[model samples]
Every structure is written in C-alpha cells, then in structure tokens.
Target: MKKTMLIIVLSVFALGCKPKQTVANTKLDNKTERLMKGDWLVSSVKYVGSDVFKVTSFNIADAKCFEESMWTLVSNNNTGEVVLNKANCATFESKITWYVNKDGNFVMKFLSEGIKAKHTTSGYVLKVANQTETSFQLIDKAAVGSNTAEIVFQFDKIGN
Candidate 1:
C-alpha cells in the first residue's frame, strides 16, 4: 500500500514539472531570424488609400537613385538599416530595430529621425502577407496627416 501511494505521488509531481513551450517553440522567432538575415533589394513599392493612390508599378530600374539603395536586416539582434540613395528625393540613411510581437506582427523602431522626416517614427507595425527565402512582402497601413495610406513593400534577395 505504501509503495502504491509513493508511485502515485511521483507521477503527480512529474506531470506538474513538465516543461513549458518557449518563444522558440512557436517557430516565428526562428523563422524570422532565418528569412531576414541578409541584404535585400527593393523590387517593388506600392501605395494606396486616402493619402496616396495606386500609381504605376515602380521598380529599381524605373528609379535610378533607388537602384543603388539597399536594405540590410540583422535578425540576430533584431536590428536593420536602410540606405536611401534617392538624392533627388532625399539624402538620408536610417538605423532601425525590428521584432515580431506577441500578436505576430512585425514592428519597426527608429533610433533617430530616420530616412524620411515625415515617415520615420516609432510604432510602425507591418504585417507579413507573404515571405520566403527569395522574397518577402510587408504591408503597413498608417495615418498620414489627416489621411490614411496603405503601403506595400516587396523585397527580393540580392545578397547575404
């Protein structure tokens, strides 16, 4: 009888001590790291909504300045940087921090004024519509002045 009671207690203790699932187990933390750790080219940029309309499809070839521009993402520390070579538009580069939040949304944090004086502030959360090793799509719906705009950024792998 004593041996049977001891076995029962041991089983209960073992069940209570089971390991919990970590952020790594969710797969996003690891996947985000794997997919973003490289240099990407801005393949396409699109905007729509009250603030902006769907203009003609544009790519690096259409914009000469943009051709030299590149986006580098370092997933190990959730940091990123963008080099804006559009001198005709602006002459600025930006350092950014990024992460996948609890809600599974991608968040960007700017340490300074950033690439665009009007566009670069904290709390820009982008949704990952689609992603793969060769390509990635991020959508950001944000308020610009009194109007709202939906911006889509499509990137293609260029190098590591």
Candidate 2:
C-alpha cells in the first residue's frame, strides 16, 4: 500500500511539473516572411479618418514623410533598413529587425546607431494586410476622439 501511494504521488508530481508547450512558427508566418523579403517602396500613406488627428508613423516622423521611403527586408537574418528620402523631409536611414509572429502581427524594433536590437525593449506591432507578391500594407490604428482610424502604409516591390 505504501509503494502504491508513493507511485501515485510521484506520478501526480511529475504530471504537475510537465513543461509547457510553446507555439511554434506556423507555415503562414514563414510564407509571409518569405514574401516580405525584398526591396520595397512606400508608394503612399492613406489616412482613413478625421484630418484633425495628426498621426506620426513609427514614432519617428509624420505619415506623409513615409511616402516614397525605401525599405529592404532581409528574411534570412530578419534585419532590414529604411530610408526616408522624400523631398522636403529629413533624409535618414534606420536599421530595423522584424518578424511576423504566430498571430500574424508584424513585430518590428528599430535599432539606433551603435545600439543592438536585442537590447531595445520598445517596439512597434502593426497588423499586416492586403499582402501580395508585389504589394502589401501595414495598417496602424489610432484613436481619433472616440473612433479608431487606420493609417495605411502601402508598399510596392521596387526591384527584383
């Protein structure tokens, strides 16, 4: 009877201590990442709501400056760069690390000069929409008064 109780207790403990199963990256995430690997240009920036609310994209500049910006997405290392080269806007380049999570959200962290991506604790999460071989959109939702509006960044593949 003692041996039987010991075995039962051990089994209960072992079962209680079982490791949690982590969610692995899905095939759709991999496919989306693959499709995002290329040179892209922000063809346009569309605001879907009231003009009174000014939205700053990526917390860096106004949404208008992002139009015509150049971006490079390297899938292998999940690292890329963005160049804000629109006329009358500040021309600068920023390194970014990005990946599509299991939930299909686009997670991106900007790395400043001399700063490593892993050390940065803050980043941006945006919903990816209208993805295609040659085009895609990054949708950022902002609260306008009591309504939620979307700032869409339309990207078009620049070159092969």
Candidate 3:
C-alpha cells in the first residue's frame, strides 16, 4: 500500500510538469512575426461554386494586376491585396486582414473601398480535404452574397 501511494504521488507530479518551449519554436515565431506585411502573389483561386477563373499558372502577366499585397504564415499561407489594373498595371493600395484559420488554415478579408463599390478581396486560408502544400488557393469565404473575397497566394521569400 505504501509503494502504491508513492507511485500515485509521483505520477501526479509528472503529469503536472510541462515541457519547455524550444529554440525551434522561437524561430517559427520569428518567421511568422510579420504575418501581415510585404508582397505576396496569387497562384490559384477557386470560387466556392460557379466561378469564372482558377488562375492556375503564375507569370509576369499576372503580376501586372496587383496594386498592393500582404501575407501571413501561421496556417497554410494567407495573402491579401488589391488589383487596380491588369497586364502589370498597378495594384491599388488598400489595407486588408490576411491570416490563417482557427483550425490551422489560410484566410483573408477585404474592406470596402467605397459605399456602393464591392470589396474585391476576402478570405485568406490555404488547405484542401487531405493535402497540404507550399501554396494555397484563396477563394471567396462565404461563396456569393458576401463582401469577402477568395484568393490564392504565392509567397516570395523576403530575400529570394
């Protein structure tokens, strides 16, 4: 009985002890520190339902359409921006919320630029049913009837 009681006490203590955070986790934190600043390109975007384009290929032709861009890395890889023109035109400068989902996914949101005009970007999450990739597809978060947008983002490492 005495030995059993001692084992129970030690077990309780062991259960209470928690592991320390390591240097690698710190590095990941640093990597995601900016989470929402810099330039990110769209690689693919799928609308929830009846959508027009998928943006499968990346190219200079697509770069021409960005006005501004931002990125986050906690999840798959979320990015948001405004497209003011096409064929390497110019991206409109606008502030948007870009991040991953609560369940470790990508997500994005675009605020209104005008009263009557629709916000062109929303949703910032990257993930599929059973696969994860280095890239993510931004699609409208709420299908139609929502002001939010869906977009695919390709991140260019800060130096590369």
Tens-place lDDT digits, model 2, residues 1-160:
9999999999999999999999644334878889999999999998875555677787888888999999999988899999998998878799999998767778889898898997998988888899999999998888777988999899999878
Q: What lDDT tens digits, residue by residue, belong to model 1 across residues 1-160?
A: 9999999999999999999865521224557656878898877666654323432212212233344467788888777887766556554466777776545567766556425433644446677767889888777664566876667778789954
Instruction: Assess the local accuracy of residue 25 in candidate 2 as a C-alpha lDDT between 0 and 100.
Output: 47
Superposed by TM-score, candidate 3 places the C-alpha of residue 160 at a distance from the truth, in angstroms, of 8.1
Which regions of candidate 1 are displaced past 4 Å? 1-28, 48-68, 113-121, 143-149
Q: Each model's C-alpha lDDT?
A: 0.64, 0.88, 0.40
Local accuracy of candidate 3 as per-residue lDDT tens digits, 4-41: 99999999999889676553111222233244344344
Winner of 2 and 3 under TM-score: 2
When superposed on Cα atoms, how far off is each prediction in RMSD?
10.8, 4.5, 12.8
Q: Candidate 3 overall Cα lDDT vs. reference?
A: 0.40
Best by lDDT: 2
User: Could you estimate the TM-score for every candidate?
Assistant: 0.59, 0.79, 0.33
